[model samples]
Target: MGSTGERAWLSAGLALLSEQGAPSVTLERLCERMGMSKGAFYHHFGSMPRFRTRLLAHFEAEHTTAIIDAVEAPGGLPARERLTRLMAEAIKNTGPELEIAVRAWAKQDPEAAAVQTRVDATRVDYLRKLCEEAGHATPDMMAKLLYLVLIGGSHVMPPLSPADKHRVYDLLLPLLG
Candidate 1:
């Protein structure tokens, strides 16, 4: 199968995972959502395990790496500006339900847990670098704190609204200077 076919399956999987959690990301559900057959899925992913692995990779690449890349794309932005862009991009690009579902899936799936661990570490490390560049007195601690706020906001009942998230960031960004 072509990359488009593979991406279709991954996209369908992500939608299902976001709407109904990992338990809904079965072959039948994906096939139904994509209007494809088991053969198509197998042709692209070979097996359910492989599909799950690929889905996790897609999630990490889209939700983590892409956000960081976008934030870093413009040369010479101040660290505070980059940090703000990072948070804005994250809130805009990633769905709260999807993030919650992935975290829930990681609780039971070792592969997912490993990916989540790596994503978390990468995000915190990037945040630390930005905080350090911004001259925060305690960059590591600030990074963890900012990351924790974002994670906590996602997991909270009803989740934080995008506007509210920005308000929170507005309140916090001044501390970075």
Candidate 2:
């Protein structure tokens, strides 16, 4: 576990990134925001690049784990149904704000971009596995398409109300059929 000061600094950094985008988040800026000395920031993270890497790694781990948990819950539901429900739930939980923040950060940091790629790959892999379990012939293609549609839809479509979300679930009925 990191020290309280270390955690506080990282939290401030994430807030800065989430609220104002990556370019506005520097060690100097974070230190000033937290009213901490440069020494405190340096104590936890060796440099700005290192801090960015750690932040991205943290986001990737949390997001992937949440996806895996949601899709693999203990149930006898059909694979396609589980996949759609899990993805919709993920989108609802992580609304557009956080997604937009990450996209903004990725545009500014190579490390963030790399982590985003890995996260997207992981999503595709999970979808492919689900399609395979459902006996789809072209699991890879199905997964890639499903992944794109889900992520793209989350951004483009309005956040579904509960009733509308179930209707959105119906749109996936064809895949299960």
Candidate 3:
């Protein structure tokens, strides 16, 4: 299949997952959304399981890249600043809908759980590296604590108000520093 068709399928599949959840990503729904027949869908993915595997891979790859990019952004920002920016961007990319989908799917799907575990590992590893770069004492503990705080906090709370969010960065910056 052409790249355009592949992208369309991914977009449609994500939409299905976000809008109606995982089970909603049926071949018929994808066909309906893409205006393609089951043949096209089958040609692209042998089965729904394959399609789901691809989608999860896409999510993990995209998010992992985003994290690395944020860290590499040219500005000489401190580690804490870089981490805050990365967290904000991640939350922006994974809004409530997709988060809900991931959470819902992870409960019943070991594959999804493993994908999430990889995501968590990537995040924690990144944090650990940043702490080490900053010469922070107890880098491992700081990284684990910060990762849990940022990720678990985001999972539970909506994005904070502008003032409160800035305050969060201010409070966290000194600790990382």
Residue 39 shift from truth in candidate 2, angstroms: 3.0
Task: State every prediction's TM-score relative to the real structure.
Answer: 0.97, 0.74, 0.81
**Scored by CA lDDT, what does every candidate get?**
0.92, 0.72, 0.75
- In candidate 3, stretches whose alpha carbon ends up further than 4 angstroms from where it belongs are 73-81, 157-167
Better of 1 and 2 by TM-score: 1
lDDT of 1: 0.92
The residue pairs found clashing in candidate 2 are none
Q: Stretches of candidate 1 above 4 Å error?
A: none
Give lDDT for model 2.
0.72
lDDT of model 2 at position 146: 63
Candidate No. with top lDDT: 1
lDDT for each residue of candidate 3 in 1-177, tens digit (9 for 90 to 100): 237777689878888888999889888999999999999988888888998898887777666666577667877887766777765665556555775687688888999999988887887888788788777888888888766555555456574444454466557657865
Error of 3 at 129 (Å): 0.7
Prediction 1 TM-score vs. true: 0.97
**What tens digits encode model 1's per-residue C-alpha lDDT throughout 1-177?**
239889888988999999999999999999999998899888898999999999999999989998999999998999989999999998888778999999999999999999999999999999999999999999999999888878888988989988888889889888886
* RMSD list, candidates in order: 1.4, 3.4, 3.0
- Winner of 1 and 2 under lDDT: 1
